[model samples]
Target: MATEVTTLVEETSAVKPNGGVTLPIYMDNHATTPVDPRVLEEMLPYFTGKFGNAASRNHSFGWAGEEAVETARERIAKLIGATTKEIVFTSGATESDNLAIKGVAEMYREKGNHIITAVTEHKAVLDTCKRLEKYGYRVTYLPVQKDGLVDLDDLKRAIDDKTILVTIMAANNEIGVLQPIAEIGKLCHEKGVIFHTDATQAVGKVPIDVAKQNLDLVSISAHKMYGPKGVGALYVRRKSPRVQLSPIIDGGGHERGMRSGTLNVAAGIPSACRVAR
Candidate 1:
C-alpha cells in the first residue's frame, strides 16, 4: 500500500485594505523557517514505505535502518572535523551540555572536583554546573568582560592544581559575541586541564577546528542548522582519553555507554546531512 504524505507549504498572503493589496514580507526567520518541499519528499518513505525500528537487530529491516543511522553519524562527524565514533547523539543542546559537564565531573572527581565555567553561559550549562556543586564539586563561575567575553586572565587565575575541567561557550547566545576559545584552550593545555565548549551557535555561523582550538570536547545542536529538532551531538576528542562521566540515566549501553537509548535513526540522518552542509 502506498502512503500519502502531505508537505506543508506556506505562501505569502497579502493584506487588503479597501480592496488594495499590500506586499507580504517574511521577517521571522529567527523563529522558524518554511519547510523545504524536497526534504519532505525525501523523508516520506521512512514514515510509510520502509518503516522499521532502528534498534531491532534481529531482522534485515532493522539492519537497513541502523545503517542509515550510522551513515548520518558519519556525515555529522565530517562536518565537525571529527570521527564518527566521537559523536554522541542527544535530545538537544540541553542534554548535550548536561552530559558533557556532569559526565566529565563524575568521571574525574577522584582526580579533582573543581570545574571552571563562565557567568554568561546558557542556563543549560549554568544549571548543570550548579548541580555539580551540590555534589561537593567546586565550580568557578568566571564573569565575562563588558563586551560579553570571558577574561583570559580570570580563566588563568581560576585554575589550580585541583581544577579538572573548564567549560565555556563558543559564542554568547543572546549577545552574539564569540569567545577566545583558542587562547583558553592553550591555557588549559599548559595546565593539563580539559576544555569543553558549547558551540551550538558557532558551529554553522563560524569555523571551528577542534585540533586548532585544542578543544577536548564541544557541544552542538542539530536544529540550530536546517535539521530537525530534538537531536544534537557532542564531540569528544579521541586524542585525549575518553571523558569519564557517570550516566544520568541507566539503560542498555549506547552512545559508547555515555548516553543510553534506542537511537533516533531518522533524525540522525537529516541532522548529519544538515551539519555537513
Candidate 2:
C-alpha cells in the first residue's frame, strides 16, 4: 500500500522546474507537496486581476482580496476546530512556532519566566526556545522515552508556578512519532500554563479539535499539508483566558496585531483551500 501511494504521488509530481527536484517527499512528509491543480485554479485570478492589499479598506479590489483571505481563514479554522477570529496568518510553521513561543514568553514575562517542552520538538520550536533562553527565560527540555514518547510525569513535574508555556509537537517530523498533545494540553490548563503544539506534521494527517484538545495555540504549515509553501497560520485562543502575544514583525497592525504585513492573497487562500477540499 505504501508503494502504491508513492507511485501515484510520483506520477502527479512531475514538475521538476529548472532541473530541480519534484519529489513529494513521501518518505518524510515534513518537506513539501505539489500544489493541486484545482487549488491553483482557485488562486490564479488574485495574482492577475484581483490583486490588492487586504489591509486596504476603502476600495472594491481590497474588499475582494480581504473577503478571499477571510474565507481562507474560515476554511483553515474549520479544519482544525477553531474560529476565524482565532487564525493569524504567518509565513509558515516556523514563524508560527516562533510567534507562539516567544510571543507567550514576552507577553507573560510578568507572570512567569519558565517554559517546558519536549526534546523531540521541531527546530522551529527548539530554536525559538533557545532564543528565549538567551534572554534569561528558563526552559525545561523534557526527555522522551526510548520509544520516542514524552513522559507525562516528567512534564507534570517540570511545570512550576513560574512556567508560562508548555510546547510539544503533535507529531515528530523525523520518526513519525505521535505525541500526546491532548494530554499535555489538559495538564497545562490545570496548572494555568499555556499549551502550544507545532501541528505542522499532524494537521492533515490526524484529527485536531482545539476545544477538545484544550490547545491554547497551534502552529501549522501549508507545505506540510500538500499545499503551497511560504504560508501558514497560528491559532490563538480567544476568551477563557484569551491568549495574548507580542508581534514579531510589527508594521501595519494586521492579523489582530499579532502578525503584521500585507496578506498574500493568492497563495494564502489556496493553501487553506487545498486542505479543506
Candidate 3:
C-alpha cells in the first residue's frame, strides 16, 4: 500500500506543463486511494470559475461556496446520525483526535483532570493524552486483553471522580479489530464521563451510529475513504458536556471558534461527500 501511494505521489508530482503523470497499477488503497475522477470534475469549477471563500459572505461567490460547504456537511452528518451543526472540519484524523481529546480535557478541567484510554489506540490519541499528563492532567492507560480488546471491567475500574474523559479508537488500525464502542460508551455514560473515539480506520468500512453508541465525540479522516486528503471532521454531540479547548493555533474565528482559520470549503465539501457514501 505504501509503495502504491509513493507511486501515485511520484506520478502526480511529475506532471509537466504539457502531460499528466501515468500510474502503473494503482493498487495502494490502504495507505491512500486514487481520488475519484468524478469528484475531481465536480471540484474543478471551484478552483477556477467560481472560486470564493466560504467564510466571505459579502458576495455571490462566497455564498455559492458556502452553500456547497453546508450541503457537504449535511451529507456527512447523515452518514453518522449527527446534525450538521455538530461537525467540525479538520486537517485529518490526527487533528481531529487532538481536538476531541484536548478540547474536552480543557473544557472539563474544572470538573476533573483525569482521562482514561486504552494502550492500543492510535498514536494521535495516546500522544495527546501524554501531553495532557505533562500539564497536570492524570491519564489512566488501560490494558488490553490478549484478543486486543479492552476489558470492560478494567475500564470501569479505571474511572474515578477525577476522570473527565474517555478516549478510544473505533477499530484497530494495525489489525482491523473493531472495538466494542457501544459497550464502552454505555459504560462512560453510566459514570457521567465523556466518550470519544478515533474512527479514522473504521468510518467507511464499518457502520457507526453516534447516538446508538452514546459517543460524545468521534474523529474521521477523508483520504481513508477515497476522498481528498488534508480534510476530516470531528463529531461533538451537542448534548454532551460543554468542552473548552484552547486552540492549538489561532486565526480567524471558524468552526465555532473551537478550530480557527479560513475554511477549506473545496476539500471539506468533497471529503464530507465521500463519507456520506
Point to the candidate with the largest TM-score: 2
Task: For candidate 1, write residues 142-179 as lDDT tens digits.
Answer: 99888899999999899999999999999777787999
Which candidate number has the best lDDT? 2
* Candidates 2 and 3 compared by lDDT, better number: 2
**Per-residue alpha-carbon lDDT of candidate 3 for residues 1-277, written as tens digits (9 for 90 to 100):** 9999999987876645544544355655656665666666666787876688888879999998888778778878888888998888888889999998888887777889999998999999999999999999999999988999999989988899998899989988887788899999898988899999998888878888898988888998878776788888888887665445656657887888878877776774454356346
lDDT of 3 at 247: 62
- Measured with C-alpha atoms, the lDDT of residue 121 in candidate 2 is 88
Order by lDDT, highest first: 2, 3, 1
lDDT of each: 0.78, 0.87, 0.82
The deviation in Å at residue 52 for candidate 1 is 2.5
Global lDDT of model 1: 0.78
TM-score for each prediction?
Answer: 0.86, 0.89, 0.87
> Which pairs, if any, clash in model 1?
103-245
Error of 3 at 18 (Å): 31
Clashing pairs in 2: none
Across residues 173-205, which tens digit of lDDT does each residue of candidate 2 receive? 888899988999898888899999999888878
RMSD of each: 4.8, 6.8, 6.3
Query: For candidate 2, which ten residues in a row score worst on lDDT?
Result: 268-277
